[model samples]
Target: MKKTVCAIIIAAFSVCVWLQNAGAEDIKIGSILRLSQGASDGLPARRGVEIAVKEINAKGGIGGRKVEVIFEDSKDTDQAAVAAFQKLVSMDGVKVVIGPMKSSEVLAVAPIAMREKIVVITPNGTSPKISEAGEYVYRGCSRIDKQAEALTQFAKDPMKATGVAILYSNEPYGKGCNDLFTKQFTALGIPVVAVESFMVGDRDFSAQITKLKQSTFDLLFIPGYLQETAPAIAQARKMGIVAESMGVYGDMAPKYIELAGKAAEGHINASEYDEDYATGKNKKFKDAYYSIVKADANEPNNIMFAALTYDAMGLVAEAIAAKGNSPDGIRSYLDSVKDFDGVTGKLSFDANGDVVKQGVYIFKVQDGKYVKVK
Candidate 1:
């Protein structure tokens, strides 16, 4: 009897040790983002991933292994993004990566991701070219052309603008939006009168605005990051050019309103997440996000980017949970997933790896807040 009791105790000890070892093993993931340049979007997105990871681990992580995310800054450049991807995959040994939010970065890293068979999900890379990036490359947001489709129609029916002028950022995303929206507006029978360009990090838009003022149009469309677009609109207003202002998804931030001041009023843009979206998931996410970021003055508050990444992290976790941690497993799970209830909306992946969400949202700034138009 003494020998039997000792054997049972040893067996229990071994089981406990095994369980501890299993729990100690972490499932690593990688995140590449614009942590330095354009951190307003990148920082919030990082917070979103943090929130999702925290929540996932809090509930006894996937298959008893804690999720560990290795974050790398893309520096808002294609070469940096490629280096980050290689480092994350080779050194960190992460099977899946979520980031390099810019379309250019995503495109830059696509070939490597495909060659290595790494699963990559970009939260905000909206250029239509990304649809053909690779089988392993996935996006979490709607394409820019889709936003143009919705915004251009809204401009035609409600805004009732006859002619439109564009001031586009010369970067890939901004230039892509300019081309797509110009086509969309023209398709809707709204002639694009004057087109101008501005470089990223450009604070002074007086030259562009001065030239834009030379053109007569009932509507002014500026497609670029709010850092430049907001100030451009402000300068345009200051320089005495008053036409209904429109922008792309980059303008959907509180900072835009703050920067543009009263100039932001009546400015319309596209959005992914709606705060008024009544869902327990959304409520929990918003509560958690504000609770964390509201106290940190250095943290930029843009829930849209955060929400997209939150959903991206959550979906990746779910994929890992269901299909295992391999790239093929995650890709299969993503391809098969339908109607994932996310903070943004019901999300699913199409054949092209583009997210099929509810659709784009049109929002106008009113009283210092974004009000949904359609």
Candidate 2:
């Protein structure tokens, strides 16, 4: 009889602990950023989420419940990403998770979000395969495949090149971009004249530049992170590969132009957010961003990193408000989100959970600065 009474007491204790945990203080949002180790651009993306969370919490949070944001670094590996994601979802018990920062990380953790019924909103992982990462996986930016189509259109319409050389960073995100570009280039009836590859963080690209210069290609399409891209373009310029160069979001940043100088001049790329292009809806947030970061309001691609993650967090908050405090409820709320205008732009999710993104304006590094090209 004593033992039975003890068992009942332990069960009651466990229930109380669970309830206490659930009713702690505020609604918690999770994020796993590959900030320090992966790509430098990922830092500003994470910062954008931070800035938004602070503002939201300061405004008494969603529905007067304060928001608590949980953060972990992805460390630029599959193992690190998976562990961070598991910690965010299982250990921290988050209702919504923001990111692991890259496509490889998204591929790892998105399955868990689906199984755990948590919404994972990746701000930068743009690989086309995200379309297949179950129902709960959502992203707030353009898909790399769709961007390839837009790029193809840009190549044919605005920046015409008789032939092209393709370069990528040999990651899932980079390879996916390369694949889409290859298909789109073929469909556009243009031959891919050459292809080159380099690992991220390599300082030299002379051999690849030599090959591209010798080839019949009149343009170069590089799909990789900005860290490698800056060096590659600088090296390509030194090696006299004068084709009109372009890259995707992995190469989106003012730092690229700052590093490459004259090499990256006239370079064009597609991005979801351009600070110069935000509607009146983003004025307050934009002002807040400049005040917090002490950055220029006119910087062209500043919106790419911080704004993307900010919108992801904002949408997560909106979903939480729509669903109260349940994971399944939040999932339904996210799916039911029809039109969410964010700091980036309107957030309209297709059935596959990617934002139907197109503020596909091309940008050029004019006067050693990133300037929007209409």
Instruction: For candidate 1, give the lDDT of residue 183.
Output: 86
Which residue pairs of candidate 2 clash?
A: none
Q: Pick the candidate with the highest TM-score.
A: 1
Clashing pairs in 1: none
Best by lDDT: 1
Candidate 1 C-alpha lDDT tens digits along 236-316:
999998999999888999999999999999999999999989999999999999998879888898999999999999999
Clashes per candidate, residues 3 or more apart or on different chains: 0, 0
For model 2, how does the per-residue alpha-carbon lDDT over 124-157 read when each residue is reduced to its tens digit?
Answer: 7877788899888888888776678778878877
How far off is residue 349 in model 2, in Å?
Answer: 1.2
The deviation in Å at residue 296 for candidate 2 is 13
TM-score of 2: 0.88
